[model samples]
Target chain A: MVQLDDLDRAILKLLKQDARLTISELAERLNRPESTIHFRIKKLIEKGVIDRYTIILGEPLKPKSVVAVYIETEIPVIEDFLEKYINHITKTLSMLPNVLAVARSGRNGIIALIGGETEEQIEKFVDDTIRTLPSLRKVEVFPFTNIVKGEDVIGFLVDV
Target chain B: MVQLDDLDRAILKLLKQDARLTISELAERLNRPESTIHFRIKKLIEKGVIDRYTIILGEPLKPKSVVAVYIETEIPVIEDFLEKYINHITKTLSMLPNVLAVARSGRNGIIALIGGETEEQIEKFVDDTIRTLPSLRKVEVFPFTNIVKGEDVIGFLVDV
Candidate 1:
């Protein structure tokens, strides 16, 4: 198990909010000595408790409309063909810029997050790109309206 | 539309990868002058193109299993209760540490992302916490087997 004390968690919580905090600022905010704060951060990084830093794009780069698509492909009799087909579809979807995220649900199920400038555009993409694929047994599109929690996730997951 | 040229896109892409890069390093890597890179970043922030700086926690802090739950609530006879009930449920779910993301899918539907130590734990959470809620017409849980795209999203959204 990952053992984290109160100090470690406090530092992580602050960093999670703003990664640009310097050692001095962190020390001041957390009421810890500068040396101790610096050492703790170094240890956290070394232990892989703090992953590599990255940036989240803002609204200017985010899509205006988003949809979560759940797709289930028909299991071919060959069984071997099922695995290959699933891999092929997942790889193809992952390469698209509009597809923000994609993950396999089960044996033949795939869930994808797609974004666009407008609902019509998203619908068109789903029709042209997703529905056109062969061997699809089920496709359900859930339109995401108001994101009450994790509202910034769209900006975070969007590619530059 | 937000007008961004090649230089702007290049800088944004690099920053998205690593926001810790200094202006001089970014200019050197992108073959632009330091002054130009500095000005561009300043403008980007002013234009709200950069959004905000944040951190992604490492695997040590991440949950071992995650699932996306889709819920549709039954419309009540009162009609007025629908909105209030949905809001109540969403707020309640959002407050839980295990519930990572929550959004209103439609007028009577909700979508949430939940994480736990194992599949059984997640299942128990859904059954004990979510399934027991009143007015729920349907509940579907989709386990994330393997994320092919936007893999860092989990770490990025996880709270410290």
Candidate 2:
């Protein structure tokens, strides 16, 4: 674990909120000297604490509806076939623009975040694109009706 | 829907990769004048396509294990009670640092992304903190063994 003082945490919190803040602005807000703020940020980057800077695209570009789908593939007779099948499914989903995120969940399961213009549209895509895939044991869809925390994630993960 | 020309999308894509890029750099890369790059970025910000600049924390700060949990509450005799219960559950979970994200799945269901140092630790958290809650109909945990796309999201959403 990395050790972080209160100042480091404060700077990280501020930068996470708005990375556009200049060193002088951060100094003024945190009551630290400009040099200290700059040094701290540099150290944070060097330590790999601050991974990267990026932009979150806002509404109109963000999907109006999002759903989390859990797909469980049937265990094939050949063990090698199951591993290959899971890899193929994840790669295929990752290439699609509508599939915002994809991950392998345990041995025979995959979880994906899918986005669309409407609930109906997303459901149709799930039924047509996902449910149609062969050798799947079950597919469950969880629609995000209201995001209470980390709501900006959709904006962060959406494709431009 | 917001209209985005090829240039706007290209600019957005580059910025999304690295928001710290200077206007001159963007211009040089895109074969456009610096003034044009500057103008386009300004317009993009003004139009709210670029929501905000942010940072993604690296490995040490990010959780080593992550799981997506779906919690469904049992419906009560009073609809009002169910509404308030769901709200209360979401609010409580949102306040926890380990609960990376929380969203209402439906009238009586909640979807939360949880993080911890290990899978066992996260399971303990779910067993102790979440499953203990009264009136839950079901609790499902999906472990993300491998994230194939949009994996940086964990870094983006993880709290300091």
Candidate 3:
């Protein structure tokens, strides 16, 4: 297991807020030497902690409906099922093109985010996207009434 | 940004699979010494790379029809509404207790995963849990047809 100290905690909190922050900027925020921040980040990469640095794009508000999806399936519950089916589902979902992020839960369901220009457009988008899934038994799409938080990914990691 | 080598990528991929691995065990898999592995993890922690350790709990295959919800809502076109509503939506969705994950694609929509024991049970659960959101003006529910990728957290991150 990895152990984290106060500085580490602060640094992570900062990065969670802004991964694009440069080493000098991060060090300045944490009141540390730029060299120290750079070295620490390097070690973190070597240890497999920081996976990668990528941009999180904001979707076009062109769509008026924000949809929330819940899923359940009837698969033969077994390890072989997990090993074989996991890859297929992952590939297909990743191909959604409009999907923002897909995450796993403690239950046998997936949450998907998609966008469109209107209620009908969003509905059609949902219909077509769900149809692309092969083993899916049932899927529910609930368009969001509102999003209280977006783009901010650190909420789960810390108390704001 | 942290510069990564192949070894660093390997470490990240492995740990992303399972964060519960012991330092010594991680070293064996990475073909590195325990001390080196330990140091790398420490450095990663200090750099805010690995956020924290957490357990993903999936309910023991219960008897509910999984529902996927898509929410389309209105947001300020010029301003950032992702954080405002996303936070609120996440808070509400999380409060449902049955909700596993809530994800959004900016202002266009929010995708949420919810589980229950039966179709009716899931329906009631959604009605009781989500109907109260003040910002949500409309909603659409799609019972999962088949899970395409289910939850691909590791698959989304790892090369293997």
Candidate 4:
């Protein structure tokens, strides 16, 4: 269990905003020696504090992160929807091969967000899957056109 | 903006799992002295990397972070939805206060995951407002009972 001191908390907060800062730069900014900064970072990794680094890959590109969207079905459908359905849906969407995350939906119907390299591919994925899911009475598919606050921004950092 | 070095990222990753770690304890675990660890943390703070410290508040007792929810509406509705409607929506949900984030559904609706204090508040918010919005035809609401992978966990040293 890691109990964050103010400094640790601060370091985390900064990175939450931007994740590419250098140690010497951080050291200079912190008025500390480069060695001190470097070692502190090394410690953080050994403790499993930092996870892996990732790149945000969309710029009018292959659809987006929510390649696989979840169509929300009403509560009445939960009985029909099962864990097996997840793998099944993933495989089903695999036909299109572009969708990313497919969970359940929130409201009345099963929702699936299409993700693909081209507009044509995305359209086909939605069409094929619409016929596949039987329990689905009405399917409302929404393609992501733009990003507001992405899934990546949601964090749990503590300020110093 | 917070830029994370390898260490800062590690610290964030570890803390997400367990936030009760002590300075010296972290130092020992990470193989650095407490002082150096302390310095980087300080820099992180001054840089505004860390946001704020908050308790998870437990899933069983507290309102969990909301995940799956899709609001199905019409896109032409966004023009009006963005005006008095969207701002009010943001204000109302923000007032209810548990909602972590809200996104435009891309289609006609807004998709969001709400972390409500109680089920009643969430249900009431949707039900009461449903009929009021003329453009909103079928407002489907789903309360998230489980989390696939915590969005907060992917975050690093800053509060990610």
Q: lDDT tens digits, residues B32-145, model 4?
A: 888977787666556545433333322222343343345554445347554556445545544444455556544455665555556676776566654466656566555444
Tens-digit per-residue lDDT, A1-160, candidate 1: 6788999999988887778889999999989999999999899988888887767788899999998999999988999999999999999999999999999998999999999998789989999999999999999888899899899899888987
Candidate with top lDDT is 2
Question: How high is the lDDT of residue B98 in model 3?
Answer: 56
Assign candidate 2 its CAPRI class. Answer: high
Model 4: how far residue A60 lies from native, Å: 6.4
Sort by TM-score, best first: 2, 1, 4, 3
Output the number of the TM-score-best candidate.
2
Q: What is the C-alpha RMSD of each candidate to the true structure, in Å?
A: 1.1, 0.7, 12.5, 10.8
Can you tell me which runs of candidate 4 are displaced by over 4 Å?
A: A32-48, A58-61, A64-86, A94-96, A104-112, A117-123, A151-160, B1-65, B72-84, B87-101, B106-108, B114-139, B143-159
Residue B48 local lDDT, model 1: 86
**Which stretches in model 3 have alpha-carbon errors above 4 Å?**
A1-160, B58-65, B72-92, B103-110, B128-137, B145-160
Misplaced by over 4 Å in model 1 are none
After aligning candidate 3 to the native by TM-score, how far in Å is the CA of A1 from where it should be?
32
Candidate 1 chain B has its poorest 10 consecutive residues by lDDT at: B49-58
Reference-based lDDT, residue A64, model 3: 42
Error of 3 at A67 (Å): 9.7
The number of the candidate with the highest DockQ is 2
Q: Give one digit per residue, the lDDT tens place, for model 2 in A1-160.
A: 6899999999999999999999999999999999999999999999999999999999969999999999999999999999999999999999999999999999999999999999999999999999999999999999999999999999999998
**Cα lDDT of model 3 by residue, A10-109, tens digit:** 7655664556477899898889999889888776656555554432212211234545455555565685885456455556665764554454332345
Q: Candidate 1 clashing pairs?
A: none
